[model samples]
Every structure is written in structure tokens, then in C-alpha cells.
Target chain A: MNWRGNALKFCDVAGLPALEPFVRLLAGEDVKEQLKGIAKFVVLPVAAVAVFLLLWSAAARTVVTDSMQLPSPTDTWTAGKELFAMHSAQRAEDLKVKQEKTMQAVTLLAQANSVTKQAESATGERKETLLANALVLKKKAVQAANYRPSSAPTFVDQIITSLKTVFVGFAIATLIAVPIGVLCGMSPWCNAALTPFIQIFKPVSPLAWLPLAFLIIVWAYSGTKPGENFFDKAFLISAITVSLCSLWPTLVNTTLGVASVDKDYMNVARVLKLSWSQQLFKIILPASLPLMFAGLRISLGVGWMVLIAADMLAQNPGLGKFVWDEFQNGSSQTYARIAFSVIIIGLIGLLLDRIMIFMRNLVSFGDPQAA
Target chain B: MSVAVLDRPRSKAIARPAPPDPLISMRAVCKGYGSGVTRNEVLSNINLNLRKGEFLAIVGFSGSGKTTLTKLLAGLEIPDSGEIVMDNEIIKGPSQERGIVFQNYSLLPWLTVRGNIALSVDRVFKHWSRGERRDHVEKFIEMVGLSHAVHRRPHELSGGMRQRVSLARTLAMKPNVLLLDEPLSALDALTRSVLQEEILKIWEEERQTCLLITNDVDEAILLADRIVPLNPGPNASLGPAFSVELERPRDKTALNHNETFKGLRNAVTNYLVAVRQKSRDDEALASEAPPIELPELQPRSLRVPRGRAG
Candidate 1:
């Protein structure tokens, strides 16, 4: 029962390159048809946006009083170009700052004279001048350390970082959620004792939790610090926050999935004298995959949003920070850039979801009639 | 030459009483659900024994608690009251010693035909190399004539093909006892008959202790060394056991003309008649037991339309 759809159809729908081999395969088999199914699923938001654009464009085609507030498609495109140019200039500024910082740090490290010696009035004014120069260089290095490229960060770069954070949080949540959920679902007592606590935490918003997380973590790790850099702290906070928010869906779904496993499979598990390992591997996991994936995908999306909000506040170096910085910049171009960023973020999120679905489909592909 | 195939096994059985003990023994068996407040006694005060290499058929109407009994034997559900001893020990849970083939063909929806079979084989024979499990499963798939669907998922498969995978999975396990809980009842007539023969052939080669639960009279008689009937559902008990006196290596094509085969068929048909009458009897008079007092089966007890002449 092969469930494979048309690859060509998927490609055509996705607007991917024809890629001769794929087209041929689709023609040769029903590969293109299956691919089309996948493409249709993924193109929903894109299609919606395209329709919105067409309508917006049709309206914008007229001057509509030629108001500056009414930024037309052409204006948006020009704005996009302007923002890109600004970012390019900003990126150059950032690189210069980084290069200067690196040179200062290297010079300081290689400096033959100690700061204390340089401060001594060995040559009167020359000594003062040397010490002042060192101090200024150190300050510049610190400032440069904070500087990042101003060029509009590519959507792909943001996606990578976004993916990293979401996956990290999701991974942490899965590690905690699946086992706990499976345990809770399998045992009523476990469910009773542990489940309510989860529900309590589940409903608590990431924004609400951020302050508490900040206070708790900074306080907890104030002493005996391990990697207390901004990036590390942001990663930790996002992961913990995500674990709190993302875990519930997976936990709830997994419990339901495990609880509702078909009795027939259970019977077969028994007859085979399946080891605990075997029972879980051959029956329980596969039976639960459909449901587990549902939870995972939900958790991932939630985590992605959570990371964005967390980053905006945390000033974590990612697209969320980009959005926050853009908003703070409060320039006309930055807002449009923000809008563009938002689109990119949504596209990345959509693609991330598709990847998980693709993995699941891989499992169900060979059996067209897989129950 | 054909007779020799059947002869080899019978001679071995006669020469060596084929191990002294019964393969599976039941003593004072009782199984039920709910408690004193809401108790439904499905099977009670039951005692039976199954010996090695015996093809035992359990016949009953739906809700006769035959499914429960099969489940108990398969180690799916624990016997609420009595003991089921396999290899001289009380069977508490499912073991590789027993393998169950479910009626609905419980193959994983995500797995291909080959993948489904290999999953069990791989899980049980964890030490076996991957290649070995693959080859082993593929051979059985070939045996069941499902080679074409080796990579197909469950939904892609026909009902008959899925059943074949179920058969293949259990056979690959090579358990000492094979439990069939109306395994072929869900299939079309043609598929059912063909699978029936496939099952018979597998049993012949493997010589495992087999217990089949079904409502079909012909199926029971055709596949069993002995047929055991359940009297009725919801407090139903085991009825008399009848030995199938048909000749060895029974030919399904030629068996209808044989007098002994006719006798066995007539006897199973009689049991079927009893089941139908019992169903009608249970139904015509509304169950005095309230819905709460009823087992799931008690509520939806199937009254299969058959001649109610006992």
C-alpha cells in the first residue's frame, strides 16, 4: 500500500525548479502527484498572502489621496531596497567596529608594557598618554564586542538561529515530556499527581514567565558562573521558557496517544512475548508517532513564538532582536523591514513544520492504505 | 508420495507419545469483569487442557465470552479467578510461548507488509542479525503470497493481505501456542477460505499447539483436531468437546464426500444450531440484568441469523 504522492505535482505547486529527473519520475510514476499533495499543504499561507497582495495592490493602484500612510506595493519594494542598503552600510560599520576591537585586543595582549608600569610617571606626559590610550582602546573593544552586522539579516540566517532555539527548547521539552507523559498516561496515579502541576504551568504565558525566569536564573547562577554571556543566558532562558510552554501539548497528546493505543496491538505484543523494549519499540512508539508528531509540531511552533518574544526582551542576538531593534529604531524603513522579517519568520516556521510532516510521511509512505 | 508427507508426523507421534504433559492446561478457570457491586461473570468454574500439536477450535456466538476466553489463553487479559498453566507454570502474562493472531489483522498502519512482519521478528529475536530477520520475514510474506505488497502500508493493503501479514508475524515468532481470535472472520469468503488453508498448512509444518476462536461451523470443523463449543454468552460456560475424526492431511477439495468428514461437519452444524437458538433465547426474553450489570458483550450480543433448530 504505497502512499507516495506525485513529486512533480508537489514541485509544480511549490514552484520549485522543474529538475528534469523529478519531472520524469513524476511522469513515469505517480511521484509528482504525491509531491503535489505535500505542496498543497505547504502553500496555504503563501496563497493567502498572494491573494492579500493582489487585493492590496488593486486598491493601492489608485492614488487613494497619495497619502504617505498608504504605502503601496511599489513603495514597499522601494522601502525594502532602502532597508537593504541601510543594512549593508550598517553591516560595514559593524565589521569596522569588530575589526578595530580585534586589533585593540590583540595589541593589548601583545603589549610589552604592563598597565601599572604605563601609568607610572616614567616619562611624565608620555606615561599618562600611554595609559589613557590603553583605557580608551579597552572601552572601544567592549563596545565593538556588542556590535553586530546592521545589514538586514537574511531570512535564512534568522531561520537557522530560530531553528536552533526552537529545537533546543523542543528537544529539552520532548526529553522531559514524552517519558513523563507516557508514564502519566500509562498510570492513573502518575497522571493525578503530576498532571495538574503541568496544567498550572501550561497556561502561564512565556511573557509572564520571563521576569521570573530572569530573576531566578541570574540569582541562581550569580555565583559559580558557567558561561554567563548574553547568548548563553538567552539560550538557557528560551529553552526553559519553551520547555515550560511547549511541553504540555506533547505531554497531553502523548498521554492520550499512549492511553488510546489499540488493544489488538497490545494483544499481539503479548503473544509475541515482546520484551518491554520490544513492546515500546515495535508497537507503542509507532502507534503513538502520529499523535506525538502532532504534539511535537505544535510545541515547536509555540516554542518558536516564545523564543521571538523572549529574544525581543532578552536582547538575544537573533531575528527577534532584529525586530525589537527595528521597532526601537522607529524609522519608516525599519517598520517595513520588520514586516519583511515577519513574513520570513512565518515562512521559516511553515517550512520547519513541513520538515516534521515530511519525516512522518516517510514512515507512512510505503503503505498507501496504512491504517 | 503425498501420503508420506502426512505419514512422517503421525509415525513420530505414535513412536514417541510426544512428550508426557499437555502443552497447555487450565484448572478451575474463572474470568470476569467488575466486582460484587457490578459483576458480570463471563467464564466460571472452567477446566480444560490443550496438548501439544492439537488444533483446538472454540466455537460460540458473539458475547458468549469466547473472545475473552481467547484473550485469556493468548495472555492478553488475566484470568480473574483461575490458572492457565503452560509448560507446567501458571501463565500470568503473554510470553513467546504463545502468539496471538487478531481478527482485525493488527498490522501497524505505518509499516509495509515486510516491515510489519520484520518488526516482531526483530523485536523477539533481538540477537538475530538484521539480514536474518529480513530473510525470515520475506520468506513468510512469499508463503502468504504478499510479496507484491512487501513495502505497502496497511491502508494500501486489501483486508486479506493484512491478515496474511498477521499470520506471517505470528509464524515468524514460532510460539509454542498459536491463538486465533476469529482471525479470518473479517475477510471475504474467498480470502477467508484461502487463508484457512494457508493457516492449516502453516500449522501442519510448525505443529504448534493451536486454539482458534470462531462462530463459523465449517471453519471450526475444517481446521480443528477437536472442536469445543461455548453454551451462551454473559455467564456462558464451555460446552462438550467433540473430536474431529476426519483423516490426516485432510483434503478440503475432496473432504465433502467423505463420511467421517460429513459426520464432523454435521456435528459442528449442530453446535451452530445450538448457538443460534441460545442467542434467540437470550434475546426474546429481555436480559433481566441492568445495563450496569452487563459486560460490554452483554449489551450488544450478536444474534447471528441461523436456523434455530437444536
Candidate 2:
């Protein structure tokens, strides 16, 4: 019984309420109600998706373009499979090439050792020639040992890049927004001063910020050569654009959350004679966490969306660039690959949202209704 | 008989001789909100003294600014005019010297019962070692009989349990003066009486100078050494103070049979009712004004006739 309750709690915490019906049913709750829940939460969504796929397949045959037809469900699945196969094959090939280079280096090192041994026992002119040969062999071995396969990133690698970029951008946005938001919340003067800038910049699109971000990053890194920089220029530019566009939600939410801490709680803090820092850390911040997380979720979602678009525009090596490059290629499989990518992007976005919700629930206190 | 004694003329001042030096004193305190014509005076020209180790209760109606008075004493709010002095120093801001149990059980919902109590103990006794502070918190939590619910958050606890945690939190601070603002008013009657008894037991043990703000006449008669009524507001002020002379280790059931308790309850209740009625009558008299006349008008039809339709 204890475990059953914990299971349900786990479901709630994980933002997976759909699993509750099954858990309840297993726990011997009302069967009829559980059945209804299963129908609503489990079966219906699956059925709806199936119906959608059927409709998509039917529609794909009807629409025809000069270049290619719209991708059917099967076509998209096939394209997704091909992409995954290609990624695995590329990884294997890279691994094989690295192994071959290592073997070549080993062989060259052995030859250099043999040549050095021969040079030690040789007479004057022959000894010099042998020593020279050994030196060349050693140099070649080092070059071979240091060999790397510089192949382009596959679809999976692009996805990983996109994920990394978005997370970095989200982290940057949160770092900048939360403290400023707290200042704005705590001090009316700070709020008033920042209001105009927030209003002006909030509505500016990521596309609009991209060029400005690019220019600033470029100017900042002007001294450093292209490959010598710590971060790639395009990656930094895209991430900055994402942060610029996405920071507003978190900023606004944190300000609201901090400002709207319950008056009663503040009175308690006062009665306790808590210092300003203590009050902020112990009372204000904890109390505002639910709303702050809600804001973070929105900011992350915005950041993810912005990152994709920024990637496409900036030609950053990510999912957005993959889609863009596919479009440019205009092969028979291009439409299908794009459709497959669309699904991946949507799923990733959904996962991000779910994670944020889970985090929000973790900090949410007092009222379940509030969470 | 105590009934005959109760029928005697009542006075506004405490019948008992005043203590030489009070722990806390409010002098001609006035607080209000708004400005000009819209200004609402909640407490005006209020003066009271909390003698050291005395249990004092201020009984009033809901809107009679009992909370404002509590906040003033707690130093959460400074009076608009006049001064509140504690230990011969003018009250500037809230300090750990005076701890308040709010009417709404202002236990931080995010904190567990232990955390709520420890928060105050940790802050107030900053010089104490971690173990000492923890023991102090545990002692108060046990005193309030909430040891079982130590790990429970405020929302997870019942209304009475939450109030108990609030009481434990304030008590854990070991303030020289304790202010309780209708802390049990939100609970059910059964829970209210239970908590009242627990509060009484704790008070008997600790004997801190305590101030209780409540609307319950019987509750005031039961727990407090003296009862002071706050008159109904716009400008609520203190009424007469009634001394509860009933012997302690007071039992609720025995108090029902006790004539002194009965008479004291009746006297306080009658006084509060009379003052409330008088205030209502004054408000009615002040609100009496000449009625204004309005112009009569008819609703005009906006429809066109059939002949005009062409």
C-alpha cells in the first residue's frame, strides 16, 4: 500500500499523470473509473495518432510537386531509418579509419626502432643514412598517431549540437535574468529603470537579434583567429540570440514571483527579525520558486524554439542547419528527411516542457492546486 | 457572592495595582490608513501597559484593528503617531524580543514543523551551538505536543496543527513578550478549545509576558490574568480591564460550575455587547443625511415606423 502511494506520487512528480490510471488500477482502485482514465489518457492519444498517420498517408499521394511529393508517414519513417543508419555507418567508418591510422603509426614506430638499431651498428656513411631514415620514420609515426577523421556531423550529431547549444543559451539567460528580476522585484526604482528596456527588447525577434549578436561576438573575438577561439563564432552568435529573445519570460516571471510573495510570510520574517539576506534566501526566494520555475519553463521553451531558428539563419551545425541543408539539396528524400526532423524537434520540445514542469512541481509547496 | 461583586460598577483601568515597571508600554498610539476624506482611523489614542510575566487579553470584534495593535506591539508596524516603548527604548522595528503568532498561523508552508520552529530558534539564539539550538527547537515542539508532526509541512497538517507549529515557532524564540493574534480563531471549536488548553499549559510553565488578541469572551476569561476589551473601530480604543480572579490550574468543566468564572464571563460579554451596540448607534446617527433628488427620464424608442422603412 505504501509503495502504491509512492508510485502515484512518483507519477505526479515526473509530470506523467497518464501513468496514474494504470497504477491505480494495479492498486485495486475503482475499476470503472480506472477504465475510463485508461481510455482518456492512454488509448485515445494512441488511436488519434494512428488516425493522423493514416490521413497523412492518404493525403501524401494526392499532393504532387515538380521536385518531390509531400512525405507520407511511411516515407518519413523510411527517411528517419536511413538517417540513423547513415549516422551509425559514419561513426563506424571514422572508428575504422582511426584504428587504421593507429596501426600505421605502430608499424612506423617499429620500422624506426629497427632503423635506429641498424644505424647503431653501421659504418660511417651508411650509419648517417640509416639515422636519417629513422628520423623520417619517427616523424611519420607521430603524424600518423595524431591522425583524426574530420568528417561532417551526421543527423544525430546535429541533434546533439542543437541540444548543447540550447542548454547553454538557457543557462546564460537564467543566469542573467533571475538576479535582475530579483532586483526589479525587490526595488521599485530598479523596476522602473529597467521597464523601458524590457518593454523595448522583449518583442524583438531572435532573427532581429541574430545580426547584432553576430557583430558583437565578432568584434569581441577579433583578436583571436577562427579555430583558436574557445567557442565557435556561429554557436556563440546563435546562443546569444536565443538568450536575448528567451530571457524576457524568465525575467518577467521572476519579478512577478518575487514581488508577489505572500504578505503574511513577510510579516513572519519581520517578526523573526531575519536579516535582509536571510529573508531573501530563506523566505522570498523559496516562496517565489514555483513561479520562477514556471517562468524558466517558458524561457527554456522559447530558447529551444529560438535556437532552432538561429541555427538555420546562422548556418550553425545543428538540427535547424540539417533541415536547411536538406531543403537546399532538393533530393527525392529531402521532404521526408525534413518531415522526420520536424517530428524530432517537436518531441524534443515536448520533453523539455515536461522536464520544466517536473522541476516546477518539485519546488511547489503548500497548495497542490498552485502547482 | 461573586455574582454580586460582578454587578458592581466597572472602571476602564485595571482594578489591581499597577506594576512599578511594565515590560512594554504604548503611549497615546494612533494608526490609520488613507489620506484626507478617505482616511480610516483604525486605532486612536490607544494606551496600554504589559506588565512583566502577565497574561493579558484584548477582546474585540473582527475589524476593531486588533491585528494592527498586535503588529504595533510586535514592531512590525510603527504607530502613525505616539510611541511604543519596550525595555525603556522606543520600538523602532521588529525584533526577536517580541514574537507574534499571527491569526492565520503564518507558518511558512514550505517548511516542515521542525524547520519552522528551528528557523526562529536558529536566528534568535545565533550564539548557541547547532546542537543547543536544535535542542531548544525540539523542546518547544515537544512543549506544544507537535513532536509527532515534526516532519510535516503546514499544508499537510490540520488547521489546529498548523497553529500549534506557529505557537512552537514563537515559543522557541524565547521572546520576553509573546503576542498571539487570534491564533486559534481559524480552527474548529473542538480544536480551538484543545489548543487553548495547550496554550494555557505552556503559559503556566513558561510564564512569559503574553498578549492575546481575540473576539472570544470565554477564551479570554479562561486563559488570561486580565481581560481588556477593544471597542469597535473607526478609532477603536480600549475599554475596561476585567481581572480574572479564578484560581488556576483552571479546568474547563469545573469552570462551568464555578460561579466566579460565570459572573466574570457575563460581565465581559455584557460590556462588549453594550459597547458594540453603542458604536452601531453612533454610526447610524452619523450616517443620517439629507436624501438627494434625481431627475425622472423615459426610455426613448429607437425603432423606425413601417412608413419610414421605404
Candidate 3:
């Protein structure tokens, strides 16, 4: 019974209420109701998706263009599989090349050792020539050992890059937004001061910020040569642009949350004689956390959306870049690949949203439906 | 002043000489909302004293600014005029010396029963070791008989239970004064009585200087050593103080049969009812104006008559 309750709670927190009926049924309570719940929550949604896919495939056959036709569901699936296969093949090829280089280096070193041994026994000119040959072999071995394979990023690699960029950008946004937001919420003076900037910049697009971010990052990295810089300039620009665009929701929400803490809670804080810092950490923060997390969820979502656009515009090595490149390629398979990428992007976005919801639920105190 | 003087309890006549100075005193305190013509006076020229270790209850009608009075006493609000003093120090703002149990049971919803109590206990006893703080919180939780629900959040608890947690939190603060702002008014009648007894029991044990703001007359009589009525508002003031001479461990069922309890209950109830009626009458007279006559009219149906049905 305890485990059943915990499982239901886990479902709620994970934003998977569809599984609740199964848990209840397993607990042996109201089988009929549970079945109805399962049908409504789980089976119905699956059926709807199936219907959607069928309609999409049927529509794909009728829609044609000079450049390419709309990709059918099967075409997109095949494209996705091919992309994954390409990624795996590239990885295997790279590994094989590295191994071949290592094997060559080993053979070269053995030759160098044999030459050095021969040189030790040789006389005069022959001895010098043998030593020189060993030196040449040793140099060749060194070159082979230092071999590095630099190739275009695979689909998986681009996906990883995109995830990394989004996370970093989201992190930067949270760090910057939360503190300033707290200040704005806690003090009317700060709020008044920041309101103009927030109002003006909040509606601005990530596209508008991209060039400016690129310029600033380029200037900052001017002293370091292109490949020598710690962070890739393109990556920084995209991330910074993402942070710039996504920070508003969190800032606004935090201010509202902090400013509108229940009057009763403030009274309690006063009565307790908690210090300003203590009041903030103990009373204000905890009280406002639900709203703050709500804001963060929005901010993260905005950041993810902005990051893809930034990546596309900035030509950063990410999923957005992959899509852009595929579009530019304009081959017979281009439409199918783009369709596959669209699904992947939507799925990733949904996953990110669910993760945010889970986090929001954790901080939402007793209000399970806060998000 | 005249009404208070006339309504003063006869118990004052038998007062002992050289009683200890009040632990807290409010002198000519006046508080109001708004300004100029629209100003609404919530409390006017209020004067009161709370002696150390005495349980005092202020009984008033809903919206008579009972909460405002409690807030003023708790130092959550400062009087617009006059002053509130504690031990010769002017009251300025809320402090740990004064703890309040809000009517809504203002328990931090995110925190469990132990965490709620521990928040106050930890702050008030900052010098105490972690174990000491934990034990102190546990003790207070035990005092309120909420040990079983120690890990439950306020939302998870019943209203009665939440109020109990609120009580424990305030008690754990070890405050010099406990201000209860109608803490049990929101509970059911059965829960109210049970809490009333629990409060009486705690008061007996702790003898802390406490002030309760409530509308329940019987509850005031049951818990308070002295009962003061806050007359209905837009300039509410304390009426006369009534002393309850009822014996300790006053049982709710048994108090019905006790002569002193019955007398005190009736007196407080009567006083509150009278003042409320008078205030209402005064408001009515002040706002009285000539009645406006309405034009006579009748609603006509949109449907055609039988003769014109074609």
C-alpha cells in the first residue's frame, strides 16, 4: 500500500499521470474506474497519435513540389535510421583510423629499435647511416603516434552539442536572472530602475541579439587565435544570445513571486525577528519557490527555443546547424531528413519541458498542480 | 471613557494594593486607515494593560478590527497615534519577544510540522546546539500533542491540527507575550471546545502573558483571566474589562453549570451585543437620507396577443 502511494506520487512528480491507473489497478482498488482511467489517459492519446501519423502519410503522397515532395512517415523513419547509422559508421571509421595509426606507430618504433641495435654493431659510415635510419624511423613513429582524425560532426555529435549549448545557456540565464530578480522583488527602488530595460528588451527576438552577441564575443576573443580560444566563438555567441532572450520570464516571475509573498508569512517573519538574510532564505525564498520554478521552467523553454535559432543563425555545430546544412544540400533525401530532424527536435523540447515540470513540482510545496 | 467607567467590573473594588506594574501597556493608542474625509478609524484612543503571566482575551465582532488590535500588540503594526510600551521600552516593530498565532494558522506550507516549529525555535534559540533545537521543537510538538503528525505538511493536516502546529511554533519561540488572533474561530464547534480546553491547560502549565483576539464569548471566559470587549468599528475602542473568577482546569461541559462562568459569559455576551447594536444604529443615523421613489413599471411580454397571433 505504501509502495502504491509512492508510485502514484512518483507519477505525479514525473508528469506521467497516465501511469496512475495502472498503479491503482495493481493495488487492487476500483478496477472498473482504473480501466476507464487507463483508456482515457493512455490508450486514447496513443490512438490519436496513430491516427495523426496515418493522416500525415496519406497527405504526404498527394503533396508534391518541384524541389521535393513532403516526406511520408516511413520516409522520415528511414531517414532517422540512416542518420543514426551514419553517426555510428563515422564513429567506427574514426576508431579504426586511430587504431591503424597506433599500429603504424608501434611498427615504426620496432623498426627504430631494430635499426638502433644494428647501428650499435655496424662500423664507421655504415654505423652512422644505420643511426640516421633509426632516427628517421623514430621521427616517423612520433608523427604516426600524434595522428588525430578531424572530421565533420555526426548527427549524434550535433545533438550532444545542441544539448550542451542549451544547458550552458540556461544555466547562465538562471544565475543572472535569479539574483537580479530577487533584488527587483525585494526592493521597489531596484524594480523601478530595472523595469524600463526589462520592458524594452523582453519582447526583442533572439535573432536581433545574435549579431550583437557575435560581435562582442569576437572582440573578447580577439587576442586569442581562432582555434586557440578555450570556447568556440560561435558556441559562445549562440549561448549568450540564448541567455539574453530567455532571461526575462524568470526575472519577471521571480520579482512577482518575491514581492507577492503572503502578508501572513511576512507577519510571521517579523514576529520571529528573523534577520533580513534569514527571512529571505527561510521565509521569502521557500514561499516564492513555486513561482520561481514556474518562471525557470518558462525561461528554460524559451532558452531552448532561442538556442536553436541562435545555432542556425550563428552556424554553430548543433542540431540547428545540421538542419540548416540539410536544407542547403537540397537532395532527394533532404525533405525526409528535415522531417526526421523536426520530430527529434520536438521530442527533445518535450523532454526538456517534462524535466522542468518535474523540478517545478519538487519545489511547489503542497500544491501538486502548481505547474 | 464614560461608558468604560460605567461598565467597569465590580471586581476592581476588591483590588489588592501595590500590584505589579503591567508587562505591557497601550496608552491612548489610535490607528486608522486612509486619510482626510474617507478615513476609517479602526481603533480609537485605545488604552489597555497586560500584567505578566496573565491570559487576556479581547472579544469583538467580526471586522471590528480585532486583528488590527492583535497586530498592533504583536508589533506587526505601530499605532498611528500614542504608544505601546513593554517594560518601559517603546514598542516599534515585531520581535521574538512577541509571538503570534494568526487566525489562518500561518504555517509555512512547504515545511512539515517539525520544520514549522523548528523555524521559530531555531531562530529564537540560535545559541542552542542542533540537538538542543531539535529537542525543543519536539517538546513543543509534544506539548500540542502533534508528535504523530510531526512530518506532515500544513496542507496534509486538518485545520485543528494546523492550528495546533501554529500554537506549538509560537510556544517554541519562548516569547514573553503570545498573541493569538482568533486562532480557533475557523475550526468546527467541537474542535473549538477541544482547543479551548487545550489552551486552558497550556495556560495553566506555562502561565505565559498571553492575549487572545476572538469573537467567541464562552471561549474568552474559558481562557482569559481578564476579558475586554472591542466595540464594533469605524472607531472601535475597548469597553470595560471583566474579570473571570472561575477556578482552574475549567471543563467546557462543567462550566455550563458553574455560576461564575455563566455570569461572566452572559455579561461579556451582553456587553458585546449592546455595543455592536449601538454602533450599527449610530452608523445608520449618520448615513440616513431621504428615500428616493422608483417609477412604477411592468414587464411586457415580447409574444403577440391571441387576436394578433396571425
Candidate 4:
């Protein structure tokens, strides 16, 4: 049948008087039912999460791995509780241990060229090393070592620290990336100048920056007069490394987003005699939102991943370091702690992604996807 | 409460005479592209004035620079070498005093119909309380007869509905001037007529100065008080303005019977034909000219590209 005839036929069926009233009555009731259905859809995920936990517990009883080192989920739960208690015992102690180890490693690597130099700097060194008078002097060695524990940071601490790093790095990246993207979108010269650089740097792996981060951080501390908090060096390094690594997605997405804003709206802005700033803020941002948010989401995810890698290498006092420490420690509880940490990491990543998506929906003006 | 409430646009509101100086005045405006060795003018020495509360339609052929002229009036682009003055100020950039509608509804896809309307209001009335923005947007949505679809997003709406939302958004801003860039061209005839009536009712009630860049002469006859014919370019300009002396609240059904309206439309048709001929002449004359030596005539196809449309 031709299109018009088909439309007429469909209308004939759909517009029946008896069906119309019935449909309307049903629809009114259906709306209530629909609300119920939506509530179920929302609740189902939570229920599914519970079911998965139950399954995991079941699997815990029946060992899933041959390695005695690897714990069942139940074992991980017990270990997790203990770790949490230990972390809560004294918050500063763990941080101090980690810091001292890193500092010891740095001090060993820096001034240990000769026994003469070591003796020369004996007064500056911590008292424990200088007290060992019976120690035999050997040829100068430049080796440095960090003491990584056999268990992860407690679940709560892991959650908190990982959350913080992701938040800090993601926030910094967002603050820097969005405006640069907007500038690139609005100005041809900026796009031209920046796109080449963005293309070049965006592909460089986050791991690639590890060497540079360590060098710069070490240099920065030594260059400063004295007595700077050692933790700041690690935090700053990881944050900057994550920020640089995570910057592209937000920037690229924002630029493309602003570029893709509808022409008619820009015309509307023009007709309103809006300032360039006003146009960017009022029109471009609102219009570019879906894409901009997409970029932000990706940037944050990348930041979270990069933070873990950076922490593991830099031995930053976060989930990243905790995970690495657990691996190196090789304790009987290591597997359980690692499992708990893995779950925490997944949850945190999910939570961070959700936060960005929420913001995206809020900013989005016309799209149903925003909902 | 009474004055503000009663200020709703309605029938029997007579249009007040425009202030002595035109609200927007365009004088000796010449715009060209491809400078130096490859220069060609798009609009040349074009002079016009937009009186307050006037519905002015500009009609022309495909390459006649109608959209260019509209963009200039709306402050979207600076002219190559001429000044466009709005009120007494030289147009520096976009402003809140004018609203524009495009042939393709430029409603942000991410926004709901109501949200799109709210965005324009939000920009202009940043100081307005949230409730005020809601109230103003609701009024325009009701005015455009889309109260049922306020929560519907742009992609969800049909083309006509999207255009209605776009109109609702624009009108909600209550600009002194409203520019329509062939807003009805993309719609089917039925939807076009429906929207035409809606837009006419809006103009009659609000009495804002409106400039419509259209190719439809009959539309010009029905809606515009003055219809200007754009002579096509390398160096196009408005030939003359024809005054539509038809009475207020002009009905579309009555348009065919109105001889004066017919005569005016005929004149516009004649002018447009002259424009088409002129463009052909120019294209033929410049056939061997450098390929780059031409004004980039704003692409006339309704679905223009994204971005600045720059």
C-alpha cells in the first residue's frame, strides 16, 4: 500500500472510539504501573548486586583457586575487617612508615657515593643509620629500596584515598581542559596551534611520564632550602602526572562539542548582541554539553586508572600504593586483601563515572539522554 | 498586578507608531569576501531602516544575499566595510534586544522544549529569579501552543513541533526585533500555514519590529508591512520596498481576494526574476574569473552545517 493509505489504515485502527477510551483508561493506570516498573528497573541493579555478593560468598566456601595464597571472598572479608581496624588504630602511623621508607630509599641513593661522603653527611642523616658503628664499609653503591607491605591499605582507607586522588586529578583536569577546548573550538588559530600538540601528546602513555615525574619530584625537593613535607612530593607528582595524562579527552571532547553547537543558536546569540564571553557561557556551553560531558567522563576514567599506576610506582599513600604493597608483601592474607581492594577500586570507578554522568544530565538542555 | 497581568499580547492592541529614529538603521552597507586580488562583494551600498513594531520581509532568489542582510541586522557578522546601526549604537555584537528564527530549527538537541526556551530567557534575564524564568517560558510555550510538549526534547518533536519550540524559545526572550530566516521554507504547506498564522498572531499582539528573510513572495504579502527585493550580487542591494497596506489581523484566507496584496506579491516576483537573471549574468561574466574570487554566498539549502555557520 502507498504511504498515505497505510497511514489512514493505521489511524482507523488506532482511533477507534471504544479503543480510545479503553486505551486512555488503561494509559492512566499504566502510568502508575509504569512508575512501579521504573522503580523496579532502578532497584533491580541493587538486588543483582546483592545476588552477586551471595554468589561470591558461595564461591568463597568452595575454593576457586588452587593457590593456598589466594583467599576465598569470605576470607577476604575477614582480612578486610582486620585491615580496616588496623588503619583506624592510628591514621598517621601508616603514613609515617611509608614516608620513612621512601625517604630512607632516597637518602640511601643520594649521599651514599662513598663512606667519606656518608660520614660527612652523618650529622644530617637519621640517628639509626649513624649508630651502626660496627657496620663494614664497602665500595660505594647507588641502590635505593622501598619497604612495600604484604597487605593492601584497609578498605575504608583505600576507598577514601583512591576517591580523593581521582577527584583531585579529575577536577584539575576538568578546570584546565574545558576552557582550552572551548578556545580551540571558538578560534581557528587556537585549534590549529593546539590540535597538533594535542594529537602528539594525547597518545603518550601515562607510564611514559613516570621517569620524568620521579626526576622532577626529587630535584624539586632537593632544590628547595630544606624541611619540606616528603608526602607533598609524592602527592604533587602523582596528581600532576594524572592531570597531564587525563587532560586530552576533556579538551578534545569540549573543543569538538563547542565546534558542533548548532548554528541557529549562535545566530540567536548574535541577534541578542551577546558578548563573546556570553555566547560561550550561555550558548556554546549549554549546546556542547552532551559531547563535553562525554569527554569529561572519559577524562575522569583515564585519570582514575593513571592515578593507580602512578601511585604504584611513586609509592604514593593511596589505593595504588596499597595494591602494589600487597603484591610485594606476599603474605598469607595478600590475596584476600587484593580482592577487597579490587572490589573497592571497581566501586570507586563506578561512582566517579556516575557523578560525571549526573552533571552531564543537569547541563544538557534538549536531549532525553541527559535524563 | 493588574498592569503586568493585563500586558499579555491580545487582539485589539493597536501598534504604536515607531519612534522617529528607526530602531535599527542600515546605511550604505557593503560586504564582500576574498579581499586583495580575489575580491567580490556580496552586498553593496544597501540602505534600509527597521521601524519599531514593523514586520519587514525581504524576498529574493537563491544567491540574492537575503540571509547575509538578515545576519548583519541580527549582528551575527560584521559587514566587510559598512556600518550597521541598531538604535543609535553601532552593532558591536549580538544583543538581547532582538530574537531570530532559522529555516532549520536550531533548538539545542540536548534541551527539552521548555529547557530550550528557558536557555534564551536564562541568558537575557540572568538576574530573573528561577520562578520568573519558569513563568516567562510557560507563557511563551502557551503562546506558541506547545504547552503539551514542553518536556519533549528536540529530537523527539516532529519538524513543525521543533519549529514551534524554537519560536517559543525566541519569543520568550521578548526582543525588540525578531528576525526570521525563511523559517517556514522547510515545513510542509499545512504546517507552514499553521505556523504562519501563529507567527502572525504573535507579531500582531507583541508588535515588535521583525525582519523576515524569505523567498516566498506570498508569505511576504501576508506577513510583512514592507517587502524588500534583494538584487542578486557580487554586489547585491535592495531595489525598493513595497508597502503592504492591508489592514491589521490579516487572514490568510482573505489574502487571495485582496487585490492590493496580489499586486505587491507580483511586484516582488518581478524583482526576484530580475535577481535570478542578474545572478546568471554575473556567474556567466565571471565564468573565466579566478575560482576563489567570489563572495561565499551563504549556503541557501535549509539544512546548513553546524558550528558558527561561519
Using TM-score as the measure, the top candidate is: 2
- After superposition, the stretches of candidate 2 with alpha carbons farther than 4 Å from their true spots are A112-139, A368-371, B1-20, B290-310
* CAPRI band for model 1: acceptable
What Cα-based lDDT does every candidate model obtain? 0.74, 0.89, 0.89, 0.75
Clashes per candidate (backbone, < 3 Å)? 25, 0, 0, 16
Per-residue CA lDDT of model 3 for A31-142, tens digit only, reads: 9999999999989999999999999988998899777799999999999999999989998999999899999999999999999999999999999999999999999999
TM-score of 1: 0.75
Model 4 Cα shift for residue A269 (angstroms): 3.3
Across B41-127, the per-residue lDDT of candidate 4 in tens digits comes to: 788888878887778888877776777887787777788766888878998676777677877888767667887888788878889
Structural similarity to truth (TM-score) of each candidate: 0.75, 0.93, 0.92, 0.62
- Candidate 3 per-residue lDDT, tens place, B197-257, comes to 9998998999899999999898898889888888888788889888788778778888889
For candidate 2, the per-residue lDDT at B284 reads: 96
Expressed as tens digits, the lDDT of each residue in A152-267 for candidate 1 is 55544455666677787789999999998888867789898987798788888899988877887677677756654544776677667767788888999899888888887777
- The complex in candidate 1 yields a DockQ of 0.43
- For residue A41, give model 3's deviation from the true position in Å: 1.2
Each prediction's DockQ against the real complex: 0.43, 0.69, 0.69, 0.33
